[model samples]
Target chain A: MTTREIILARLRAALAPAPAPVEAPREYRRDAPVDLDRLVDRLTDYRAHVHRVAEPAVADTVAAILPAGATVVVPPALPPAWLPATVTARSDDDLDHTTIAAADGVITAAAVAIADTGTVILDGSPDQGRRVLSLLPDLHICVIRTAQVVANVPQALSRLTPHRPLTWISGPSATSDIELNRVEGVHGPRTLHLILLP
Target chain B: MSRTFLGMPTTAPKGVGHLRGAEPFPAAARRALSDAQLRRNLGHATATIRAKSGAVVAEVPDWEQLRAAGSAIKADAMARLPELLEQLEQRVTDAGGVVHWAADANEANAIVVDLVRATGSDRVIKVKSMVTQEIGLNEALEAAGIAPVETDLAELIVQLGEDRPSHILVPAIHRNRAEIREIFLRAMPGVDPGLTDEPAVLAAAARRFLRQTFLSTPVAVSGANFAVAETGTLAVVESEGNGRMCLTLPRTLITVMGVEKVVPTWRDLEVFLQLLPRASTGERMNPYTSMWTGVSPGDGPQEFHLVLLDNGRSAVLADEVGRQALHCIRCSACLNVCPVYERTGGHAYGSVYPGPIGAVLSPQLTGVADNASLPYASSLCGACYDACPVKINIPELLVHLRDQAPHPRGESAAMAAAAYAMDHPALYAAAQRATRLSRLTGRRGRGLPPPLSGWTADRDLPEPPAQTFRQWWASR
Candidate 1:
């Protein structure tokens, strides 16, 4: 028999007297009323800058965080209205590593925003671009609609697609590797800016 | 060098799947305790992690429910492990990923070495994985002339310093800033001589050194935090971007996973994802959690292979009461909160897994007799039980494992004699009278010589009292 068959045989023998699998008792909180205020507070606690802006003023929030003439990379599906006209914008569809690394920051939309943990889930959807676009650059400016915010983890998981590559970002790239002391800004974006639109 | 089909040793004559350690727990712990610097380093590190986990765990009001869900989910997975694995293999194969099964570490390492060799690359980038460490994959690769570069910051510290991991989460928890700086200067080529002990400086130096390797390395090896049997999705949860880089940039990816890591569904991840980050690194969510299902056309690692390793998990699962140890998520929460672990650190455990979980796990994964001293390592204060995220009854399991360990013939004989004496009331009273006679020889509640002195080495024995309680009651 192949090693796989042997292992399966062993497992079957071991599990003979064990009970069958049952539904997990998920009596924990599954949903919350999408609270943008709580989301902003939690995001802020993770050291990500929380910018609450009117839908029309989205470009201004992006402009405020970046220097003049700053080169920004945006996912191909990113709404053009979100990027300020003053800065040079490059679409991330056909960008190379060195080119993306050279950009000042990345701007994209999140598939869902988890309010409880202050996490933003990106599913490589059209607007979110590929995982590399958000990862290689030094700064990330993520936009989440108020409607995308979910109260808790189970609620957030229900909305996400399992097959798509997922990057769940809570804060800027951080590390507690040094004596377990948390210091932000390691490899991903050093600065994470979350814009919540009502 | 390997185990037979029956899980007996092929190279080593006696113990199979046992870690190579000469000193027992007490001997190693004594040495670890005397090292003042190591003690301070471990003390500060565990204390900080403990406080952070406590704060985050308290925030979730339904944390207890979440723990129960996590436990039940794992129990269900173990119950249906065979079917789940078959489903996993089929799903991964359908998703364009290959799955290989290895009965022990030797087979797993050989498979990984051959995979890297097939890539025509002698070097591979590694993400921090306990299973790979458990199997001694690095040593196997090195023997095959393949160089594996560790990318996680703590792992980099351990690798550069030519050291073994002392803590599960923070492998270099025994080393502080000054020591890390020294290791970097001595080992890291072309590093700045003027580098300071500041964490940011050290971290940046590591980033600069590893970035070139991440970009250049064609093949990467990782351990999966969770592999969903239903969808064949694999998750790698990490604090640093090193994991992300390895998962994405590499052309070929090989993931070594213990069979017990399988979750029945992707949604089962919600409980663990919440429990893990909070329990480890005390974060509401870690900086990055990367999940992928097999191979994607243009995204991350064109070639994917999952090596399902069952080095000794089958043995662990065979024991009815002891199987609960498989529920460990490798969050290191129990390690951080364990009072014994805080003082002794990971090195004393003499296994890749250390702390309260390791003490219970290592002995069972190997034969209990091979790691006989481990069950006695704990004070049984039940601190590990309270801190465990999955609510593994670690204390009860420790006692169960102790029963499996081979006791000294003399000790068993003494125990039998004591039991016999206690069963007879007249003899029990006579034995009490005999114990009271020690008061005459053992002056000042101490100084009982020879066999009795072992008990009073660090503590004074309570005076037996001149009269037995029964005699005093009779007089009253």
Candidate 2:
């Protein structure tokens, strides 16, 4: 018999008189109001710069966060208005790793945000292009709409489509390997700027 | 090798994986305990993580409820594992991914090596995965003339030092900053002439060294933290963006996952995603978590292969009471909280999996006879049970395995004798009275003679009082 058949048969035989099914108790909090302040607190705790701005000022905020004349990679569908003329913006149009790595930063809109854990979810949506676009760059400038914020993981997960590739970012890359001391900024983007729009 | 002509084997062959240590736990633990430096590193690391994990866990008022839910989901998944795995395979295939099954470590390793060869990549970057370590995949790749680059910082440290991983969350928890700096300076190519012991500086050195490889590596191998059966989605939770660099940059991504890692649905992630980060690295969420269902065109890796590795997981699942060991999320919370682990460190347990979880898990995977000493490695303090986010009752599993473990004839006889004496009040009192003879040796016996000495070698045998407690009570 094939290894697959052998393994499945072994499993079946082992579970002969299969145990009774158990219903998971999901009594944990869910579907609660998104607390923006809590989200800000968590992001700040992780050393990510957070800026609360009016929807109209998002363009100005993105511009101010980037160094003048810096090159930034943006998703193909990112709103043209969000990219100020001050920075040279390049769309991720079949960008290679080297090209993505060469960019000074990356800007993208998030799919959802979790307040309790201070994480931003990016599905490979039109605005959040490819996962590599955010990964290779040194700085990641993520724009989160207030409507996109959720209370916790379950709520944020409900909003995500599983088939789309997803990347959840809680903070800039970090490691606690050395003496268990948390040192932020490893292979991932070292600088994270979160622009919260209402 | 003898040509065996015998009756059919009564049981399946025991695991030939990295489940057994070179020596028994007591001997290995003796060597580790003598390393004062290792003890200090373990003590400091465990204390720091315990504080951090406690603080974050306390933040959530519903942590207990979450733990309950996490435990139940895993139990439910195990009860219907065959169905979930089949579902996972079907979904992954439907999503344009290939799925392979391996019944043992050798099969799994051969499959991965061939897959890498098929891609014609002599070198493959890797994410830190316990299953790969358990299977010794790196060695297998090297034997096939392939070099596997470890991207995770701790794993890199362990690799460069030619060291075994001593902890789960931070594999190099035994390494302090100065030691890491020394390793980097000695082993890493193009390392700065003057490297500081600062954690950030060391991390930067790694980033600089690996950035080129991450950009160029054509193939990557990873282990899934969770694989959703319903959607065929695989999630890898990591701190550094190295996981993204691997899962995204590589053209052909191969993920080796134990069959037990499969969850019933995508939504089940909510429970684990919450429980894992707090229990591991004491974070609200790891910096990056990448979830991909098979392959996403024009996005991450276009070709994905999920290797479902049984490698004794089915054997572990076979035992009714012992099956709960499969529920572990590899958070290493139990390791951090275990007093015995804090003292002797991971090396003592002698398995890639070390600490309270490993004590029970290793024995069952390799069978009780092979890893007999590990079941007794714990103090049965119940700390691991309390710390487990999935609520694995490790202390209970330890006792259960101990029952199955082979005991020396002398030890068994001693226990049986003690049990018989306790059954008879007169004999018990006489036995207690006879213990007074031990006082003649000294304030303490120091060490027992012959067969009994093994038990007292690592532990202290308190001196018998001048009078028995029962005698004193009767006099009063």
Q: What is the DockQ of each candidate?
A: 0.60, 0.67
lDDT of 2 by residue, A17-118 (tens): 789999999899996887899999999999999999987898899888887899999999999888888999999889877888999999999999999999
Colliding pairs, model 2: none
- Where is model 2 chain B poorest over a 10-residue stretch in terms of lDDT? B3-12
Tens-digit per-residue lDDT, A40-152, candidate 1:
88889879999988889999989899998999888889999998977899997668777877899999999998888889999988798878888877889999898899988
Best by lDDT: 2
Considering the two chains of model 2, state its CAPRI-style docking category: medium
Per-residue lDDT of candidate 2, residues B21-58 (tens digit):
88998899889899998899889999999999999999
Worst 10 residues of 1 chain A by lDDT: A13-22
Give the fraction of native contacts in model 2.
0.84
Name every residue pair that clashes in candidate 1: none
- Candidate 2 residue runs with Cα over 4 Å from true position: B1-17, B440-448, B468-476
